[model samples]
Target: MKNQTKWKISTLISLICLIIPFSIYSLWIYVFNLGTTQAERVSVFKDYFPDFLDGRWSTTIFSIIFSISAVILSSINLKHLKKIWKLINIIILILSGILLFLNLFSMM
Candidate 1:
């Protein structure tokens, strides 16, 4: 009972970490597209970015940071989870890896 509760809590935490970064990125994209001009979108992100950093780099950095965090959290709980939950954790890890890969590739 207690063990199951712990797994549930960890699973919920893992799910939140998995979703939040991508949700924030998607929101950024939505807002960017809604702008009247490309300059408007660029200016908005540029205002907060350092002179040396641009949108792609900032996005890749954010993705790597958040995905690594999700990977760590999912791995910590993985062994204690049930079979179906184990599969879910594996999927999350894989997706996070893919996210990191694509982001890094874009930086090239």
Candidate 2:
């Protein structure tokens, strides 16, 4: 019972971590209009948040870090999760991996 509860909690945390990068990317592309050109996107970030160090790259780096963390958290309790939760965690893990790859690729 206790182990199940712990796995549930970890699954929830993993979900939240997975959501963060997606939300940030969505906001950047939709709300902020991640512009058509690289220079335009950089300008948008600069205009909105000048304090960030290389705003676009900084966000990408943060997303990579969060996605890595999510992958770790999601993997921790995979064997202990209930059927539905296990499925969800697996999806989250896959998405986190995709996000990690996308972020890394964008940096190149």
Please count the clashing residue pairs in each candidate, in the order shown: 0, 0
Q: Which consecutive 10 residues in model 2 have the weakest lDDT in total?
A: 47-56
lDDT of 1 by residue, 4-104 (tens): 77876887777777786666566667768867887887677566546665755675686678778778878877888888888888888787777667667
- RMSD, candidate 1, Å: 3.9
Model 1 TM-score, all chains together:
0.65
lDDT of 1: 0.73
- Model 2: runs farther than 4 Å from truth? 31-38, 46-56
Q: Give each prediction's root-mean-square deviation over alpha carbons.
A: 3.9, 2.4
Error of 2 at 74 (Å): 0.7
Poorly placed runs, candidate 1 (over 4 Å): 28-32, 35-38, 44-59
